[model samples]
Target: MELTILGTAAAEGWPALFCACDTCKRARAVGGKNLRSRAGVQFGKTHRVDLSPDTWYQEAHLGADMSALEYLFVSHSHDDHWQPHCLAYLRPPFAHANNTPVQVYGNEAVVRTGRAELGAEQTIAVFNEVAPLKPIPAGEMTVTPIVASHKVGEQCLNYLFASEGKNVLCAWDTGLYEDESSWKFVENVRLDCVILECTCGPSKCERYHMDYEHYLAFKERLEKAGSVSSECIFVATHFSHNVGILHDELEQYFSPHGVCVAYDGMKIVL
Candidate 1:
């Protein structure tokens, strides 16, 4: 499976659209990887996790082709992650020679929110409500949704993608593993690639997101539980300007721990 890190910033994006903070200024000056978009990832042009508003920009600037996307797995209804407006382009004059209806998988809110956006007249896409621990077959992999502690009154999810002999954990927008069921499910599966978020950067956040410390703790806990493969690749992404850590700083902080810092357009083949 080929996984592409499409966007790596938190909801507000690094160097947020409307902020003149020192960190944002530094990000602007650094340019390159320091400048990030909202979070999302694509697997082999067919399976994608999250549908950020930056999808179009990623496609144009990063050379990502989503015209062949078949399955879209949404984490929650957050606009940064689930921008259903893009679905409009999937059909009509915007797209040509593509008749495959994109299958969307998410929780109840995801379904409702998407439906509300597309309305009753829309086609070219189908929404399937996904539940935690319920594995569903994709083209060549099985997607298992895991509960994530991000939003209250919403069934937020992290995903475990198992294909061939490799397992990938897409845990962006996730906090510490608090639910027993979530932990039990993760404990049994061996992860080869972990795409976890370090949204809070240097700050300490254990609720809706993770910080640099939380990233280490999460990795340590996974190691202690013996759930990671010997050659597992751990990546830290989903940055925020609030914490003042740019891409280089992130690399400096996480590199020693064998955790890679993801940048926009980064691709990993497993």
Candidate 2:
């Protein structure tokens, strides 16, 4: 499986749309991986996680071909992660020669919102409501949703993707592993790659998102639990400008721990 980090920044983006903060200024002056868009990831050629507002920019700048996308797994209903408005382009004159409808999998809220926004474009998009822990066949792969502690009343989720003897854990917009069921489920699975969010950066916040410390702890716990092996690749993504750091700084902090700080267009093949 080939996993591509389409965009790495959190909701507001790295060099936020309208901000004069020092971090944003630094990102603008040193434009490379430091300048990031909203969060999204593409798995292999046809499957993707999240649909940010920056999808068009990523497609144009990163040379992504969205027309080939067949599966879209949404983490939550947050605007930065799930931009249903972009589905309009999947239909009518905007997109052509795409006979395959993109099967979108998500929680109740995500399904409802997607249907409300893209129902008229049923020819190109289909929403499938997925429950936690239930494995669903997606093309050649099997995906299981894990409950995430990101929202109070919403059923936000992380995902476990298994294919070709490799497993991937996409854990974003989540705090610590407070759910015992999720922990137990992951404990028995061997993960080749784990994508974790460092939205709080160096700080320690466990309310809705995790920080660098929390990330390290989680990695340690996973390793100790035998879920992740020595060869497992750990990646830190989903950055926030409020974290007050750029890609280079993040690399400097996380590199020694064998964690790759994800930048836009970064790809990991397993």
Candidate 3:
């Protein structure tokens, strides 16, 4: 399987859309990997995680193609991760040659948002409301939604993707798992890769999002659960400019701890 991290920044993006902070300034001047869009990922050419608002920019500049996407899994209804309007482009007058409907999986709010955006009669995509811990089959992979701790108003989710003897957990847009049951999935499934969020950077915000400290604790918990091995790849993404750590500095800090700092357009094959 081939996985491409389409973006690596938080909702505001690295350098932000409208900020003049020193971190943003440095990122703007440095360019290249220092610049990041809203967070999202694509698996091969058909499956994607989180439909960011920057999907168009990602496609135009980052060598990403949404034209052949067959499956989309949204973490929540957050604007940065779930831009429902993008589904509209899959229909006539906007898209071509791609006639197959994309299967979308998310919380109830996410399904409602997509349905409202596409209107009741639209058939370009099929929306599926997924529950936590229940596995859904997508092509050859089994995707299980794990409960996320970020949003209380909705049943936010993190995904565990299992396919071809590989188990990859995408755990972000959330803090540490609140309930012990949230860790139940890891008991039977070992992870080959983990992509987690370090949104608050150096601080420790364990309620809504993760900081570096929380990130470490989370990893340790996973290790204690025997969910990951020494060979498993651990990637940190969804950075905020408020963290004030640039790409190189982030590498300096995380690399020593055996964690990869994700940059926009980073690709990994498993």
Candidate 4:
């Protein structure tokens, strides 16, 4: 599988729309990889993890031929992840390439949020809402949407994208799954790679998001339980500006633990 990190920042994005914080300033000055948009990931152009408001930028910057995206896996209906207003741009004359209808899978809320754009369009596109633990097929992958700990009245998901005997744990918009079932399920499943978020910092207030400390602890637990093999690639992403840490700084903390910190445009083929 070819994995591409389209954007790495949390909701507001790195160097947010109008914020003038020191980190934002530095990010602006150090363009390149430091410039992170809202969270999203693309797998071989045929599949994508989430859709952020910066979809256009992601498409352009990644040099992605949007036509390859036949399936869009939505994690939640959050503004940063599911910007329905932008879906119209992908309809009709806008997207003529592959012209394959994009099948979007998510929770009910995710469906309700994007369905409006799916209507009255001549473009080839369809939206499907999926519940947790239910397996569905999209292109070459079989996706199992798992429950997430992000919000109320919505389906925030952590997906297991499996194909060709390999699986990837795409965990974003999820807090540490405190539920016993969540951990029990994770303990038995083997993964080639795990993509999780580190939106929280080292600070103890990491209830809704995992901090570096929590992330490390999670990795240790995965390792200790022997659930993950030595070759499993654990990648940390979906960073928040409030974390107040740079990519290199975060790398130093994760690199030694066999965890890889993702940057925009970075690709890992597994």
Backbone clash count, each prediction separately: 0, 0, 0, 1
Model 1 alpha-carbon miss at residue 245, Å: 2.1
lDDT of each: 0.89, 0.89, 0.88, 0.80
Which regions of candidate 3 deviate over 4 angstroms? none
Task: Please give, for residues 1-270, the per-residue lDDT of candidate 4 as tens digits.
Answer: 878888889898987778888888888888777788888888886888888888889888776546667888889888889887666766557655564667888888878767775676525557787867878977678988888777866657888888888888889887788656667666778888998888875555546678877787777777777778778999998888777767777788788878888888888788
After superposition, which runs of candidate 2 have C-alpha atoms over 4 Å from their true positions?
Answer: none
Q: Estimate each model's TM-score.
A: 0.97, 0.97, 0.97, 0.93
Tens-place lDDT digits, model 3, residues 1-270: 779999898898888998989999999998999999997898888889999989999989888887888899999998989999988888777889374589999999999989999896458899999988989999988999999889888878999988999988898898888856687776567899999999988865659889989888888888988889779999999998888878898889898889999999999888
After best superposition, candidate 4 residue 110: deviation in angstroms? 0.8
Residue-wise C-alpha lDDT for candidate 2, range 54-130, written one tens digit per residue: 99998899866677889999999999999887887876677784646889999999989988887666767888999
Model 1: per-residue Cα lDDT at residue 163: 93
What is the alpha-carbon lDDT for the whole of candidate 3? 0.88
Which residue pairs show backbone clashes in model 2? Answer: none
Whichever of 3 and 4 has more lDDT, that candidate is 3
Q: Clashing pairs in model 3? A: none
TM-score of 3: 0.97
